[model samples]
Target: MEENATDGLPLAGVTVVELCHSVAGPYAGSILADLGADVIKVEAPGTGDYARDWGPPFAHGTSTLFHVLNHNKRGLALDLRDRVTCERLLGFILDHADVVLQNMRPGAIDKLGLGAAALRARKPALITCDLGAYGRSGPLKDRPGYDPLMQAHGGIMSVTGIEGGEPVRVGVSIVDQGAGMWAAMGILAALNKRHVTGQGSHVSTSLFETAIAWMSPHIGGYLSGGAMRRPLGSGVTEIVPHQAFPTSDGYIMVAAGNDNLFRALCGAIGHDFAADARFATNSNRVENRRTLIPLLEDIFRVHASAEWQSRLDAAGVPAAPIENVAQVLASPQTAALGILQQAPDLDLTLAGLPLEFDGVRPRYRHSAPALGQHNDLLSEPIAPEKAAS
Candidate 1:
């Protein structure tokens, strides 16, 4: 077995057994693994993770997306449906794993007798996370859900697209990824609690709940009798001059967050907008957006995006060019952040965790494993203490 290169990472000694597929669960496991958890990803023997085939953009015979989500984890091909295999897994978890993370189909884990309550009953130091679609107890609990379904049912799509246009899904799988983040956070909290109490915990989260949390600002307003927020294209409902405006060459997003910023923006653009009563304050500009935006739009179109960005930066007003994926990837800012990383033994560059410790990002120690690559562990010698415990 290849040794883990995680000596200095926070989770170096933690062990995670991940029985999951697709984005949300795998993403959570990836986060833990990146932070130096010894994550063993157990998949059904033959087909493995469904995400393996989720693309025409394949690399190493699997989807690039799958590789991106599954790196830094060992792979085990064990069919839980097999009686002996299931028992073997249970034994492994009770003996070795500190955490078990899963987003299997609803009711599947309990059906297999591998539910959090079941496992934690045997091993008081074990943590388990259930990343569900709807929730643990709800009408839609048993129904399978994907990212788009949650996005639509959870009301994100209703406020996502252009104003006066049919609602559109956000380009990214925000709900799945957010739910995964929540699951990771809950597990981390449980781990902390375990350290203090010598008892493990069951952490539960769902895509539906994550969606609601993301919609807090909107929901708060609507619950307080504010009208339903309509989509504002690249603009926001509360802030005028906070959207992308067309430039002579492309688009630049201008954000005049306060009256002072608005004044600076006006000065930078050579417009006396601050002197105009209808646009002097943020509230005034918001109230008069219909009039103010069109006038500003005409002025913005006279300059290229680069020219406006320079002016806004010089004036200390917040602004950015509307960059696409390729543009952002090629940017100096992106390079400076060191967020994109290449795996040590693969010809792949992927986005790393969006955080660092002591100014050092976690290393991409290895590529994602091939299916069942570490299945020999079923026969490998278990540490005597681990086995006895």
Candidate 2:
């Protein structure tokens, strides 16, 4: 493929019909849009996507979340139960759309006659993705799911907080976003398969599946039916010296993944603990972590976080001060990366896709649309007979 053939957009001629809401489904549409697909978001009549109102932090009178998750797409509002609208959407899919993505409750799309089976039967070339709450086929297939619920049920929260502390949420919607990314990846693979076999595929993922995937390491290790260990909080179970330590001022995260970094870290802190029998190797350190952690803490608290960070950096030890959100956004690295962007109609700065095309990050060609902003696409009234011909 020529670089200029797509006018620099990888998915230039692809069309996506997004039958979705909230964070996960719309985020998948945004991912496609970022790659240059023409994404048309189908929302409910009147109120639109629920996430549009999910805020005290509104931007331009709507939830900033809507702005954050939905960029570079069109919008249309219609109730599928309305036969005319359903047929129009179906007709649009049969005739024009290359991809259709939905995150509705299980069986809801099928009830509306727009499920993968129905749509694929009509347009065998259409790539379809379903983002289910739970998985598509399980005893809990019909169960409604969310990020926090998956975190709890899939054991993420069980291994998240301090050993005796209350279970804590991961502070981000990992399950939803993870499933969305999985859906997008599946769609891309389906598109590739279609290119060769001339047939589409049904790609599906769930928040539950994503949540369990996040526990692969911990859960895999416990396959022998051992009891779940208490949470270590900001530390990895298999690695030692990999947690935040309090300094005289703030805190610094120190990671000595191997023996070399461990030795260097010990040297920088002026500790001969690397020579001590109990802490001679990484495995030995893990076995004696309870004893070693306190000794390291005592040494760390003698210096301020910044001073320790400087020393660790000079010694080539992996270390950094724990930065808050504000500090992170303001850091020089963030500015250099230039992942933030703005479109003309958008009133606020937003983060763009974290990918570069030909060394330039793709800018938002359009901000999130208002409700039914592009309803004119269906103004001519859809005709299925004409599409099939």
Error of 1 at 74 (Å): 0.5
Q: What's model 1's TM-score?
A: 0.96
Which number leads on TM-score?
A: 1
Q: How accurate is candidate 2 locally (lDDT)?
A: 0.85
lDDT (0 to 1) per candidate: 0.88, 0.85
Query: Could you tell me which 10 consecutive residues in candidate 2 have the lowest summed lDDT?
Result: 380-389
Off by over 4 Å in 2: 1-6, 224-227, 380-389
Instruction: Give all TM-scores, in the order shown.
Output: 0.96, 0.94
